[model samples]
Target: MAYRETVKIRDRKAAQREALLAAAEGLVREGGFAALTIQALSARAGVGVGTVYRYFRAKDTLAAEVFRLATEREVAAVAEALQHQTDAAAKLEQAASRFARRALRAPRLAWALIAEPVDPAVDTERLRYRAAYAALFEQMIEAGVRAGELPLQSPTLSAAALVGALAEALVGPLADHQADEHVVQQLIRFCLRAVGAADPTAPEVSHEQVC
Candidate 1:
């Protein structure tokens, strides 16, 4: 009986934590990270301030979790989008387009995940996730070189540069809330040209799609 009761209590606590995180994310989306507060979050989440504190001791902790969750979703989406695409150039273009579409769909979440100041621990985790995504670009670049689609050179540097350029081009305007479909298409074209791909057009990845 005690074990069952403990399990139930644990489940309830987990649910409450999820609720608080969801509320915090919504608040950040509506405003910005500056608007996230324990009291505000507690009210938004329909939980007491003490309950919010139980889940997250500080605003920074909650903010970190929000970014972590958003980044994790992005990593998953990118991986999933690239999974079935076999061609190197196609994979790269698809990944870039999908990423842009996802960012456009969740502008606020994108800004919070990429532009907001986060704790060191969260930043380290984000870097690891980013590196994992970069590895896909590295693999695609190497494949392009091996297939003679691209010149045989430093694949790692080239991949890193391409990824960095695409990110910089796409994310700045997005963080500024000025990103649109046309801007995303232009960024995709730029990335494709930088990669030396034959085609610079992004195949129709829907805006609703998460990458």
Candidate 2:
């Protein structure tokens, strides 16, 4: 009987933790990270303030989790998209397209995730997630080069460059909420060309698609 009671208690605690996290995420999605205070989170999550603190002792910890949740979801989407294609260039294009589209769909959240100033903990999360993106791109770039579909290049440097360029390019668009479908397509083309996927002779991604 004691074991059964303890199991129920653990299950309830897990559910409360999940609720707090979801509430934190909603706060970020609606109003950026500034609104993610413990007080706010508790009310939004329908839990007591102490309960929120019990789950996440600090705001930055919760904020970092929020960033990780969103970023990891995007990485998964891109990874899944890459799995459907065999061609290196197509893989790159799909990855870029999915990433841009996802950003455009949520400009405010994208801005917060990509470049918003935040606590050191949240920034650390940003760096980690950015590296995850770069690593995925590196794999595609390396594959393309070996297959002769892309020119010789340092996958490490090139992938890092691509991730940096794409994030920087979207900064203003996301800030101004100008991230339309057109801008998203432009980013896809720009990334593809930068990685040698847009060889002038072969030109897999055409100017129209790019523009």
Candidate 3:
């Protein structure tokens, strides 16, 4: 007869894996992927280093997993923001603001996700997620063009450019932890102009309202 794992054993294993992942995420949040070593994860999770190995066969795999988990949340946020607004221009502006605001809110983690030097595996994930963001922007840009809300442009190129621009603009400020509402507001205006949308009537968004 073949041996089988019981329900209790499977549940316990799942819980342990989640705990390890949560601890790994916490370490990345506080100090970036540079701080996420198997031994460090063991200490944080209060498990043996060998246990971390059980969940993640290698360090690169672990780093990539953490990157994917954190970046998915950010992408979802921008997508959600886009959905909430009525027009293509408003959706673009709101999505840009939401992304910038969230990055400012978590500068350290944002820096890690945006520009940290890590293994090749993690870099691959970064490129994939950047494309994910661009895809979201591409849809909106295409809609705006069709609706006559935006000037004629190549949505693919424009969307990719917006992702690159937003990342580059925030890298310096995010690294220094100086990003704020002003930066977010500027980003919104920049994205609007880049996409040929109307400028925001308000000089700046109220920090009180945005944050």
Candidate 4:
């Protein structure tokens, strides 16, 4: 007889893999990335230590996978939020707002993904995801410039600046804890000004709306 796979066995294996990843994510959420070890992850997932190795070879690999998964999900969400908006400035506003809202709501996860010092392997993964985020802004900036909605500037550079500004502002102790609404607004306004996006809501010469 030829070798064949059973649906039941494949489903069970898939479920176990998901469980392991979930446990890794939970550990990072609760205690940051350093807390995710093979023994600790096995305990958290209610699986044997060997089982974790079956799914992932090392802690850094697992941690990097978790970061990729989370960031990919956020990318999809921001993309969806930007579907209805036509103007580049409005698209930038909505996209930045969506990213800021999620980061502010989950500060610990945000911190780990944004600025937590980790293995160089994981750092490489972080840079990849950050580039993914910058691409979103770059696309919007290009559209804006073609439409004459924004001044002529290097979209790639502007995108990188916006990504850095947003991540730093939300991640470290540099952030304020009160009034998420106010903070999100400030971040959006900064993004518009940085891109020279000409929106009616953008404060040109006022100190009040700048904050």
Candidate 5:
């Protein structure tokens, strides 16, 4: 039937698109975004140039999709890590460490998602994702303030500053090589101190105690 043929064609196109994305991700993992080219990707993916063009009109569009996929994975990891920990400081520490570790594990992908030049539409979406992340930290900071553990006058600003600092310090090591856990811990401690935590060296505080 005509309808059945149309459905089969659509399914085949979907599979091809998925293949292109997978091939792009592999290229990015092996050699970074700069190494990705339509010709190379099409060849690697076993697709014709026209087939690749049918999926992504431009290289920037494909790059944006790649960035989106990478960022979604990182954000999900951060959200999952935060869910298991309740205390503000503890959650912050866990989140930072998890992010750093993930970044190091996928440095090329991280650099593409976070550090590379992206299309305007993709940049806007990225900003919204970052704002959501910032809001989660703000809530944690507010809980710390209520518990008399943090001296932050403005939770939003404090949360943003801490996140920005952690991102900046970790990005370089993530791009170039492995980051030292001790250094990551030290950065965590510094963030705790900045928020007016009495002693970063003290034993971990429980979520119940803070709540």
Candidate 6:
């Protein structure tokens, strides 16, 4: 009986932690990290501030967790896009289009993930996820080169540049709350051109289908 009770307590604590994290992510989705205070999180989660502290020792810790959670979802979406298409160029296009469409769908969250001034912890997470994106692109670029879809070039550098281009291109528009398919198409074309892919025609990504 004691062992069963212990298991239940552990499960309950885990659920509570997940709830707090979910609330933290919601706050960021609506207002960015600046709005993710412990008090605010507790209020949103219907818990005491001390309860929040019990899960996360500091605001920076909490903010970093939120960043990690949000970035992982973004990365996974792009990864799925890359995996869905067989052609290397097509994979790159799909991944880029997916990223841009998702960003346009949630500009506030995108800005927070991309360019918002944040705590050191959150910034560290941002850099790590940037590398994660570059790694994904690098694999596609290498495959393109292998398949003769792209010219001979350094995949690592090209991948980093592509990631930078996508993020930088969206910064101004995302900040301004502008949702334009033209922008996403341009971004896809730009990435293909930069990688020296032939016939770089970018397909339209619908704002309605942004996931």
lDDT of 2 by residue, 1-211 (tens): 9999999999999988887888788888888898889999988978788888888889989899989998999899999999998878788878888888888888878888988889999999999999999999999999989999999999999999988988899999988888888887677777877886763324665555455
Worst 10 residues of 4 by lDDT: 170-179
Using Cα atoms with residue i matched to residue i, what is each candidate's TM-score against the true structure? 0.85, 0.94, 0.92, 0.91, 0.83, 0.93
* Candidate 1 structure lDDT: 0.77
The top-ranked prediction according to lDDT is 6
lDDT of 1 by residue, 68-134 (tens): 7867788788878888777777777788888888888888767666656766756776677668767
Model 5 agreement with the true structure over 19-73: per-residue lDDT tens digits: 8998998888877777678988999988789989989999878877876776777
How do the residues 89-118 of candidate 6 rate in per-residue lDDT, one tens digit apiece? 788889989999999999999999999999
Q: Candidate 6 overall Cα lDDT vs. reference?
A: 0.90
lDDT, model 2 = 0.86
* Candidate order, TM-score descending: 2, 6, 3, 4, 1, 5
Error of 1 at 198 (Å): 1.2
RMSD, every candidate, angstroms: 5.1, 2.1, 3.7, 2.2, 4.9, 4.3
By lDDT: ranked, best first: 6, 3, 2, 4, 1, 5
Cα shift from native, residue 104, model 6 (Å): 1.0
Backbone clashes in candidate 6 total 0
Ranking 2 against 4 by TM-score, winner: 2
Ranked by lDDT, the better of candidates 5 and 6 is 6
| Over 4 Å off, model 2 | 199-210
Off by over 4 Å in 1: 118-122, 200-211
Please give the distance, in angstroms, between residue 75's alpha carbon in candidate 2 and its true position after superposition: 0.7
State which candidate, 2 or 5, has the greater TM-score. 2
Find the candidate with the highest TM-score and give its number: 2
State the weakest 10-residue window (summed lDDT) of model 1: 202-211
* Model 3: per-residue Cα lDDT at residue 172: 95
What lDDT score goes with residue 190 in model 4? 77
